[model samples]
Target: MMLRQPCSWRMIIRTVTVIGLAIVTACASAPTRFYTLGTDAQPRITSSTASPSFRIEVRPVKVPTAVARSQLVVQINAAQVQVLEDDRWASSLPDEIRDALIARVNQQAGAPGAGTVAHGEDVPVYQIAVDVQRFESWPGSHVLIDVVWTVRTSADVETLTCHSAVREPVSDGYQALVGGHRRAIGVVAAQIAKVVRASAASATDSPLRFTGAAGKAAKGISCPHAADGAQAAADSAIAPLEE
Candidate 1:
């Protein structure tokens, strides 16, 4: 039998280096994924020969500082969170939310055009402002969104403020988590649409009314759904950092 020679330290080091390089190359070559809040669902608004009643302008959205990054931040536990480097939003978090809200609210409210003055110049324009108070993501658990939204006339003569909190359950995937958040945003959009429709109807009946100090409060306006009601059930269906 021939005697076998032991591998030298230099050779072993070279082999280890090659393996490490290969691993690094593989990781570097891995494709990153981008997600958006926009859904594939068809717009609920149907074609109508009648002119649109009003228009909407969705203002820039405001999101919490904790989740302002492009990367998808997920809750690992109560005390910690994980930022997935390979997964990212197609746009900034605020932009994504605002875009989604604009699309869904237009669909729900049946607003023919958004942010357009070319036509319907005589129609009323409602400016929608949204401030996201809480945006939480928890993998294998649920996603929650708490938003304080306001709708005001173009002249700022009347304003109505409302709040919505939506929670959606998800399974154990990033896509599912994102879908949950998307549905939550849809719920918020629906609530805004309800208020918009009500406001428009009221405006047609009589002069827009305001309650409370400074004529900023809306009378008899509530969230579209209750905390534990059919709307919540229909929407049914997360964070770290104590949010």
Candidate 2:
């Protein structure tokens, strides 16, 4: 005969408590929202007279360390920065920028864009590369982008290096900020297209040339406006992320 005691109430309470705590933790965690660079947002350019443009390939985009993470980074003040864990890019920021640039360039130039060139690719085409010097959004204010870009032909005829700044007004939200960033990037793409077209047609007397190795990856700088003023709180804290 064995004596059996009742179930241990303490053990039952401990298990119940653990399960309840887990449920509470799950409920408390914020949801993550993903975004893209709007690669397909622009209206496709259609023209019977569109010039034959050089084949274009974009190298991996280079972005500043501050914004190289998966999270969305915003400069709220001179000293403070916000990294929004809940809001992030669908792909790496650099990758997204490269894709967006290619789409925009293709639309304008009627030239198909190629993916990142792997080693030994050496495709006989024009390669456009961009290094993001600064990409920053001041919610309720503006989006600013500064990039150093180069265009070079696989034939090694011409190369162009230029630093361009683009600014767009935002309407008080991260969504608006992203839209503004897209617009700014589109502007840069257009500029690149113009140059590539000129180079391809052999229309210019002087071949475009720049110092340094073309398609060379480079490090990026801090937020363009981080030194301007007041820092906003983390985007997760300030913006309501949709489930």
Candidate 3:
């Protein structure tokens, strides 16, 4: 004769039910925040005039020997990257911006005809070198991109030197930086294209042969430019590449 158990089957069933309910409640109450980014945020404008026919090569922006070697040079701080205090981050901006610029240029100037170099070729007629100086979010809620750039021949010879600065307001939040970056990149692409076109036109009309003046001047000059603070846009939307 065994003694009867105090707990009934119904009690055990109820206990299990309560435990399951608690687990479900906790999951439902938990926060599920999500982050997203856009492909193109800032506005883009193409020059009304025809884009330069010349194929220009763009190199990654680098810190010049003069500035890097100088003790007076100010370095980018880590806090600036994480918080995006300004739109200036070392190397990151150039890498990302360069990619975006390439996309925009390709879009603006449709695919090449026969006899053109393959896409993403290293060899190009004109070469562009950029120095970032003041890339940051400004007091007016605008992202300012200041770049000192020079154009040269394919052999890294100098042609012309010019400076350009663009200030675009940040309309979207963290999710839109990718798009925002693309928009900013479009501006840079257009500006560089214009400069290249002008230089090419000048060379054509000049009494003195081009003899690669573009490459020489660009090589000799070293200028400091701007970069932006770092902020990751996790959900960036990209448009499909056109055929």
Candidate 4:
């Protein structure tokens, strides 16, 4: 019987080192997944009958600093949060939100063009600014978004400020959580589209009517609910402020 000499200490150390390196390499090579708010699917909001004459320019969005990174930040508990390194946004959070809002608003409002004004063209431009006050993701529970948005034409004919808070229940996956946030954004877009459509109609009827601060105050437009398919059993509310 050949007695196997106890594995040499040097050999044991080398074997352990090689195993550790292999594990590290495997972990380092793990594929990262990226997500985007934009979707190719048909928009949920009902399209307007006439294409809007004015174009929409969605300004860059602002988000909380805690979730400003590319990685997905999720609330593990009331006091704890986790950042997933393997999952990231396709773009910065602000850019993602702005792009999503522009897409959904254009689709919902039936706007003719996006984010750009043709040189020397006499088309009205609606500038939409959004500030995200609270963006929370609770996986397997819900996703909440609190946003304050403002709409003003390039000519400054009228201004509308509104606040919207939407909370959507989600299932047990990251995809579902993202979907919930997408739907919440759609809800906000629907509210903004309502304002755009109304303003456009008013302008068509009387371009010079809503001109000064007094005229803007007299408009008294209330925030509207999410358009046809935009609301999905979500808790949402919109508060309009005359400006």
Candidate 5:
């Protein structure tokens, strides 16, 4: 016959309890992954032509401090939940936005505008600088991009500024994150290009109108001949769109 010790039974129970807790904790933690999009490979352009009616230049985007700080998981708060993938941080964030904007601008510059052929000559009679104001991650795996762009006439010294934003959603998982980021960048790039193009049209339109009104005013003042210089100057003012 044998007698069971109370202390021995209690020790066995405690060991089993610790093992169960370890298993539960492991199951509770969500997996982490890392990912990257747009490799060291050179960027590609789908087209080589654009209009020549106006010139445009694009500047690199500047990121804010808050944005940089937010990229790390250790910094995320209750309101923010960063998605990690493939042993790497998520690529859908703004870490890659500036590059996207640069690519689009280059593509635009390489292509001819409405009035000229893209021959690698910088015809853009204007320069534009883009300042990124709000680029961040959104709820439900989405990203938001906002920027304020200032355009200056390279020929006349006129200036105008505009602002715009874009919100895009992501798909599930790491692979999806890369693809979603590409698509989102494309959308933002298109929006930025559109704004720049609009500004170009406006700048040309303003001077063109001034030229016309000046020509008419000269006729009324019996000084129509004096307007020839103005018209010629305006015509020459049109610069090649920079690629």
Candidate 6:
């Protein structure tokens, strides 16, 4: 006859096995994926051709509390929202936007560089401020962004305030939504570059102050002008070949 096992030992062993299986199942079912809102900035400029006179002071981005967390926000409806557990931003949304803007403005615009506020930092000739009022996505539908930005300089009495709403279509996947947002940001970056180029044209000290954006559409720094027309409701492509 074999020695009998204690009931308590068997129960504990069974419980431990159940917990291990549960852990494995959960891990298998919900693997986390990280994403960022970065894309090839539109209207890119080669290093040799870069032309802008003003150095823009990029202020810290302002994001509302509603969508400030790391998780991806999905608007199920006007009254409801879903925060995905497995799909998330690689960094805080505001920080991601700030980094994206800093990198893109430097590459796509004529600015020498961009920087945050530092001790004893010299005053900047031109300044850029962005407020992200709304950023959300409907996974099966679209990614939407509503942002207002202000451009200020030492010379102008009135700042140029502009609002942009970008809606990019996406398939029924969080990855697609991420792609949409990246392209949407690229579009916004292009707009800011347009304005900065204009300001450079109006300056006196910087060498690029007299240079203009090289095209019919690029009428530099004409503030007190109206905003651009509404963008398409569903544009998924980020770095389009046409640009």
TM-scores of all models? 0.80, 0.69, 0.48, 0.81, 0.47, 0.72
Native-to-model Cα distance after best TM-score fit, residue 207 in candidate 2, in Å: 8.0
* Steric clashes per prediction: 0, 5, 30, 0, 29, 2
After aligning candidate 1 to the native by TM-score, how far in Å is the CA of 118 from where it should be? Answer: 1.5
What is candidate 6's lDDT per residue for 1-243, written digit by digit as tens?
899976798899999999999999988987889998765433344222333345666788988787899998889898999888888899999988887776666555556654433424544476778999989888889998888877766554456667777787899888898888876776676677666655555344452222122212123444222233122111323235344
Candidate 5 lDDT over 33-142, as tens digits, reads 55443433323332344445555555555666555432422114546655333145445334456555555544433434324435355545546566767655543376
Clashing pairs in 4: none
Encode model 1's per-residue lDDT on 103-164: one tens digit a residue. 87776676775454455368778889999998999999999998988888775555677778
Ranking by lDDT: 4, 1, 2, 6, 5, 3
Which wins on lDDT, candidate 1 or candidate 2? 1
Ranking by TM-score: 4, 1, 6, 2, 3, 5
Task: Please report the candidate that would top TM-score against the real structure.
Answer: 4
**3 or 5, greater by TM-score:** 3
Pairs in steric clash, model 2: 76-230, 76-231, 76-232, 77-230, 77-231
Measured on C-alpha atoms, candidate 3 has an lDDT of 0.46
Q: Which stretches of candidate 6 lie over 4 Å from their true place?
A: 1-8, 15-20, 24-29, 40-43, 46-52, 114-124, 154-157, 205-220, 223-243
Itemize residue pairs with steric clashes in candidate 6: 198-220, 198-221
> Compared with the true structure, what per-residue lDDT tens digits does model 4 show for residues 174-199?
98889989888878888888777777
